[model samples]
Target: MHRAPVVLERAADREAVPDDVWVELRRAARELGFSQIGVADVDLASAEPGLLAWLQQGLHGSMLYMERHGLRRARPAELVPGTVRVITARMDYLPRATSDGWQAIAFERLHRPTEATVSLYARGRDYHKVMRARLQKLADGLAERIGPFGHRVFTDSAPVLEVELASRSGLGWRGKHTLALSREAGSMFFLGEIYVDLALPLTPASEAHCGSCRACIDVCPTQAIVSERRLDARRCISYLTIEHDGPIPEEFRAPIGNRIYGCDDCQLVCPWNKYAQRASLPDFDARDAFDAPSLLQLWAWNEDEFLRRTEGSAIRRIGFERWRRNLAVALGNAWRETGDAALSRALSEAREAASALVREHVDWALAQRDTPALEPGS
Candidate 1:
């Protein structure tokens, strides 16, 4: 059952949004495609230590932006001046065509070994654009009701600790995989935040429900999840393919399987995701090109075709270089797993014209044909 809309109470020195106003905010957010909304106080002092520890361990890989922001990521008031409260939102992103047993379906993609498995999230339009525009509209609706207030919006931004705010504001609990997970919505949704000067009443946080389940930790392809709520991103395929600019690490290449972009193995195995919801908007619908594409098929795309096909998609942001690099690694894995001559031919053909970084990966991929497969856990 939906939690009743929160009642706003007057606090000294700040205008109190009426209970009816809170109802209007909920209505506006819902109309804007937000599944849930909650307020979190700006004080995130307690989360700073964990953020610092994660960065100190060099687990963030080459994503220096996480360290550049420092503790400001935990302290909302520091990142956005005068922000007294954060309005956190969640929007489910599972494509509407998602079927029952979707997790099993995702697992089946891995078994194919030759198919290019883009993470489900990136299979649709760029969610950063979709979520930002909707968040701004939600903010505008709030302004229309209570007059203009100081506010800024963020969606998957580096400077903001999104899961920290989302879990603290009753959106969900931070799962063992370190992504926000909800009992009702699972971990499949995207999160956004509006930093506002208003001192809105804070919502009670959600309780941890992961229990004794270690499915996420056990299911990771590269063991990126070192422990509960701890991730070593250097080994994470998502980080390597999308964020890391260097050659895909040899240790992780084979384990990355046919995932040409981000990996969803953890979320795919989480039992709670059985409750994942379908998106209310068509903006997240999967494009035909991403639905079970082959390694050679994607590798066949020249830079121009890559640019044209990935226009307005999140995959484009990685640029053609990393795109080819990731494809090279996946093609290598496909060749190793299937011994398919077509994949080997595609890898060799691309190597001739590939950039230095991509060519190195292409060379590595071609060498996979000569390497014998190791037994599980070897």
Candidate 2:
């Protein structure tokens, strides 16, 4: 049923939106390519203590922004003035061609050691751009229906507690690995939120389905999931490879394997991921460059080639230095696994022209030549 536009005299207040508006909003969100939308009240005071505890434990690693924002991350109203409710949305990001037994295929890549494995979510377009743009369009559609209203859209922003909002809004439950997961979609999705002044009906939070399931915790290469729902980002491969700008820690280097961008082992091991959905949009299709490219192939690219190839992709955000740093570490692991002499020669050649940081990593990688060799898949 098509409804007439809701005219408002000024920006919406807590009592402004009717129940039907919520229904229309969901319909519009579906039209705009979101898989689910849920409403969370602005009062997130209950989540503050945990947030503080995580920071106190220094679990956020070098992401000083988390410490700077502090509890403002929990309080939506403080982050965005006048926010009475938060609208959380999730978009399934698995590429359209992700086939059956995809998890096994991903696990197989770990055994090869030479093939660079970018995270499935990052194998395509930059999701930060895709989610933010679509979220804005969803907000604009809402405004067209109920007239202009105060709102802001956020996608993986530093100040937003996205997983909290997602869990509270029934989009999913918090997995033991600390990522939001749902029975319907598992953990293969991107989360975005819209903070608004309008009061919307809150969706019931989903029940935690990870009961007794420790697959994610056990599969972690670095044991980053220190405890249930508690992540030590400093030990996390995803954090080390992408967020931390300095040298890759020595202890975790061999465990990193071929994951050059982000880590997906936890998600790949989860039993529920058998039901993970494919993206409805073609924007997430994996480019040929990331389709099982080898460590040597990636190592061959110069800074200019790296920039040119990664122009529109999220991999570009890590920059050439970190990219090379991660590749260096993975190359070292590959040498240990296969004792490949070509990899050693490449690492040696790159070291002469490398920066101090990259040179240090390359030297470490060259040192791996003396390490005892192992059979593939061992």
Candidate 3:
């Protein structure tokens, strides 16, 4: 039934919006392409101790920003002066053409020690840009209604407890893998936040549905998901390849499979991912080299090719050095698995990479050339 027209008009011309305003806000969010809209009151004090403990354990790896912010991250009002409530948003990002049971496709890739694999999330345009712009647009639309109210929008930036807000706002439960998960959306979506001074109605939080599932923990290559919802980033392939600056630890090397940029095993093994949704925007479609480039083909790209191809993509942030370093590791694993002549020659040339970091990784890759040759079967 069509009810009254709920509208927020004129700046500072507003007091507190009625609870039913959430219905209108949610409708607007759906029109703007968000999968879910949730409101959360600014009470995250419980998350503070875990945040500090995660930092103190140095489990954040080299992301110093995680350590830089104090507990203001847990306290929204402190981060943004008048943030009485937070509007949490979720956008589904699975690639559009992913076929039925794509999780099996991803899981099979992890078994091929020769194929270079990247996390599904980074295969397209940088999510940081895609999510932040839409979030700001949503915030702007709200400001237009309520008038010049204090607000801040963030998407994976510093000082925002994104997962905490997501879990609290009825969007989803925190999965055992540490990502926010929903029975409907699984865990394959991007999260964003808009902090506003007004006290909007909050959504009823979702209950934990993980139950006894431990698929995410058992499949971790580096055992990074050491325990449920407790990641040890030091051994995480994503942290080692993208965030860490030094040598790839020797111990974690063989277990890494061929994931060059990020790891997706845990998500692939999760049964709930059958509910994963596809992205509506073309901005997230896979492009250029990310669309299943072979290890040798990708290893041949020079620094200029790397820079130009990865422009505006999240992979570019790792720079050409780490790019080569990661590819070299993958090529090395390929060599160990197949001992292909082409793989060996590529590793030889890579040994002289312009950057010292790249050269070191290349040399390590070449050392795998003499891996024990497969024996004849009985």
**How many residue pairs clash per model?**
0, 0, 1
Candidate 1 C-alpha lDDT tens digits along 54-77: 999999999988888889898877
lDDT of 3 by residue, 1-378 (tens): 111112212224447777666676778788777999898988898888888888899888877877778688998877766567899999998888778978877777765656678788898999888888888777767767656566677888758888889989999999999998999989999999887767687788889999998988987877798788999899888899899878898777666657889887778888888899998777778785886778877788888998889888999998888888888888777777777888878778667545887787778777876764321110
In model 2, how large is the Cα lDDT of residue 320? Answer: 97
The alpha-carbon lDDT assigned to residue 344 of candidate 3 equals 78
TM-score of 3: 0.92
The lowest-lDDT stretch of 10 consecutive residues in candidate 2 is 1-10
TM-score for predicted model 1 compared with the true structure: 0.95
Per-model TM-score, in order, reads 0.95, 0.95, 0.92
Q: Which regions of candidate 2 deviate over 4 angstroms?
A: 1-15, 373-378
For residue 329, model 2's alpha carbon misses the true position, in angstroms, by 0.7
Q: Show where candidate 1 strays beyond 4 Å.
A: 1-13, 374-378
Error of 2 at 348 (Å): 1.0
Native-to-model Cα distance after best TM-score fit, residue 109 in candidate 2, in Å:
0.6
Candidate 2 per-residue lDDT, tens place, 290-377, comes to 9789999999999999999998899999999999999999999898878889999999988989999999999898888677754332
For residue 134, give model 3's deviation from the true position in Å: 0.7
